[model samples]
Target: MRIKYKMVLLILLPMLVVIGAIAAIVFVQEKQLAAQQTLVLEESLLESKRAEIMDYVSLARTSIDLLYSSGRNDEATKEQVKAILRTMNFGQDGYFFVYDTQGLCLVHPRQTELEGRQMWDKRDPTGFPVIQKLIEAAQQGGGFQRYLWIKPTSGKETDKLAYAVLLDRWGWMMGTGIYLDDVAAAKAKISQESDKRIHGVMRSLAVTAVLAILIVVACAVAVNLSEQRSADAKLTAMARRVVTSQEDERTRIARELHDGISQQLVSTKYQIELAQFQLPESDENRAAQQALEKGLDGLGDTIAEIRRISHDLRSSLLDNLGLPAALGQLANDVAAHTGLEVRVDVSRCQHKLPDTPAITLFRIAQEALTNIVKHAAARQVDLLLSSDRRSVALTITDDGRGFAPEAETYAQSGGIGLRNMRERAELEGGSLHIVSQPGHTVLLATLPLSEAG
Candidate 1:
């Protein structure tokens, strides 16, 4: 996979996982909390319903008390009390009933057929004696009871909440009830609404999570692309510099040959022709002796120029005497040319290195020496080469008036030399580091040794 894709996964996978986990946890917890709240709300509402039942029963008892206190204690008054309770109605299935302690129905507003009938053993669908339980509750000073009973409006057996109280003076059990399914319906409605709101919240969080992952992926891609562009630009510039450096080297070599060796060879050739024209006819060997001698001197100068050019291109001594000898020669030449105190120390690198690495290190040292000759004002220079079983290192130290390290720009101060040295070190799988301060500058190159090289 491409690095950008890998980075996107690396940046987003963990974030998405955490978000998903948190969302799941929140959703589950919210649903659980909603269920709990529904139960609490149902209880609160059921309690209020139970209170309404008590009030209805209390009003019926008060009406009976008023009739008794009015001194109307007769069959007529009893019938009147029954008429008042039968007419007391609020909603569907809302009414009062009166039964005797023996479970005989006396006044049933909605079910008049069961009036004056013995219902002491009447049981609901769940096998509870509904009439017996209601009679007991009334005789025990009014309380609530839950059971299945016939709903007057629907004419079907449904769960009911009833409250009852005793009429001690009349041996009557009077009570009223409300259907339980109404409360259950309210609870169901509340639960449905809660689920809708919770689901909405979960969806919003999911969208937020997805958007967050997209943002992270976008940022990662942007960073990777930026880095890739920067790398490409650097490679392009380095390639251009390599081509320019090669041409510059070729031009320098051409100039040296044309100005130094080529001119001297032509001069030597003319001198030889002149000597031939002035040859001693009698074999005295003195007529053209000066011309011949001057030709020989010219030939010597030409040979020296050729040798210098060859050394500039590549030193034969480097292949023969190895890197240590080559570096020592370089130090000597630099000292001769620049009048600088130069030291070559290679006591620790006696082992011969591979050919390519040896050449790279030599070139780096050459470039450093050239830079010091051209730029550094102070004289003393030290070149050290060392090696161990795993790696080899070279250190070039010069006590010179140094340039401002921070303010130094490769373009402004001639970057080619430094760039070439660094590139050479990298080609050999080595690294180069430079530290410079006032009157002191150090350049170090370290190359690891592999089994093959």
Candidate 2:
């Protein structure tokens, strides 16, 4: 894959994983919350339904109690009580039932065919004796029971919820039931609505996750592009400076050759010709000899100027006598020219470095000493070089008036000398560090050493 896309992935993968994990956790929590809420809602509704059914049963019991109070021992009054129960109905299929303690049906308003019949052994679809269990519930005073029975309105076996109580004085069981299919229907409806809400929440979370990921991706790409642009701009500026530096060097060399060396060479040539002309003249030998001496002096000055330029570019001692000797010569030259007290130390360095490492270290030290001479305005400078099998280190310290090392100002300082030294060190897989304060400044360069040949 292309690096840009790879970078984008690197930026987004971690965030995506975190968001995904969080979303999953939220979904699970939401699911659990919904289940809890649904269960509570169902229980609340069932409690309300239970209260309504209990009220209906209580009304029936109150009326039957009144009838028994009017004629406790009258058979006619008891028959009238049965008639009142059979007729006291609330809705379709909602009515009362009566049975003896022996499980014989006395009044089944909805299913009159079961009246006066022994239902002792009769069972529902689940094999529980329905009328027998109802008798037991009534005998225990009053409570609720669940069973399957033929619903009159639907003519199908349906779940029933009944409340029953024993009429002890009459030796009878009286009860009423509400079919539970309606309750089941209500609960199922609530469940369906709850599922819809849960689904809605899930969809909303999905959309949020997608949007969050998109935002992260956009931010990552924007940051990466901005960094890349800034880096490109820095490289471009450095390139332009390199070109300008090269041209300036060429100009300086060309001017030296033209004004100094070339002029001297021309003067020598003219004197030699004049000497040849004078040698033929009989009493002009002294003037010819003087011209020849002046020409030789000019040639000597030209040679010295050429050597100075050559040393500025690269020292011959660096190649012939190795890094230590070259550095010692640099120290001598700096002390001679700038009159700065220069201290040199190289006692620790025991191995000759490879060409690149040696040159890189030497160039850094050269730049540092040059900077000190030009700007330090101090009387003392220290040059220290040390090395072991693994690395070489050079340090140059000067008691100089220092300035703030602001990054922008340093980069725009218009001199490539410091930059060149730093680049050289970096190219050789080394580092250059500079620290400065009032009356104390240090430059240190560290380079890795290659194995000796």
Candidate 3:
């Protein structure tokens, strides 16, 4: 992928992971909290139901208090109490029941057919002994028990909550119960509402994540556009600088030829004419022979000067002997001209670089040496070249009064030479780095050689 897309993924992947984790955490926590809330609400409602049933049982007991407190254990008095309880009921599915200590049904207001039947082994759908547990609760003083029973209104087995008490003298267990399908219905409603709320929260989180991703993508696009524009501008400027530098170099070479070599050639021509004029007399005159020799010597010096200028324009050594030799000759020339200590060290390179990379490194070295001569006030310069299988590197070090590598002038002012060197390295898929302290400066350039072969 392109760098911008890679950058977007780099930013977005982590964000997506974190968002997903947070959403999962929120969902799990909310679900747990909802379950807990439902449990608390169910307990509260069941407690209220227990209280209501207990109050009903209390009222029934109050109604029979006079009879029971009369110290009568006779069948007629028991029959009268049963008649009163059988008629006292709160709702369609609410009624009283009575059983003996042996688990024999005595009074069942809702199901009269169940009266006078043995109920000791009667079990609910879940195998709970309904009559046995209710009789036990009555025997052990008044208490509540939960079981399934036939609801009077629906005539279906439904959950029921009951309170039971013992009439000890009568040997009877009296109880009343309320059907509890409403509690189950209430819990189902709560669960349904909780699910709806959770879905709303999840939707909100999903929307937020999408919006966040969109915002990040938009920002990345904006940054990419801005960087592209800036890079284009810099490339244009660098192109202009390159053209200007080329023109300036041509102009300088032209002027040098005009002012130095052209004048010397003219002088040599005049001397040759003088030698010709004196040549006819050379067999008879020693001065004529001397003039001819002087002219030839002058011609030789002019040829050497021309060769030097040609070498400066484009080194023949670089084309014929490769980069190492060219750099060594350059070092020699610089040291000879500037009277500065210049050293060149080249390691045995196993890989030969292609022309562009070789020339780029050479030019970088040339620029670095020029900078050291003009600005660094250096006494000694070292050029080191080494290569591996993958890349070639050139490092130039100077023992000099070094300037700040981070100085703005190198980018903003008359520092095109440094910029040109860096641009050259980069154009060849390489890089240039400079490090400088008070009395030491180093310029390093590296170019990859993988594509050279």
Q: In model 2, which runs have C-alpha deviations exceeding 4 angstroms?
A: 1-7, 70-75, 212-453
**Model 2 TM-score?**
0.44
Candidate 3 lDDT tens digits, 176-250: 988889889988987888788779878977997788789778887332246458657866676656545654554
Report, for every candidate in turn, its global Cα lDDT versus the true structure. Answer: 0.76, 0.73, 0.78
Error of 1 at 296 (Å): 99
Per-model TM-score versus the true fold:
0.44, 0.44, 0.48
Q: In terms of TM-score, which candidate is strongest? A: 3
Q: Residues 1-453, candidate 1, lDDT per residue (tens digit)?
A: 998888888767876786688678877876886788678767866865875686566546544554644445588998888899899887877998889889989988788999989999999899998888888887777888899988877878888999988877778888899899877787788788878867887887789777777777667643224645865676667665654565455446556665655565566557565655665555444424543555457556655656566576666567788889999998998898779999999999957787667777877887788778888886899999998767899999999987654453641465346756776777556898888988899989998887654
lDDT string for model 2 (1-453, tens) is 988778778767765676577667756765675577568656655654565566566556645654664436678888988998999898788899999889889998888999989998989999988888888888897877889999898899998888888988888888888887876776677667757866776787678667756866676443234645865676567555644454455446545555665565556556455545655544434544554555556555655655566566667678788999999989998888888888999988888777668766776777677767776787898888899898999998889997554455653354456666677677666888888898998888998876662
**Superposed Cα deviation of residue 197, candidate 3 (Å):** 1.5
Off by over 4 Å in 1: 1-7, 69-76, 218-453
| Candidate 1 structure, TM-score to reference | 0.44
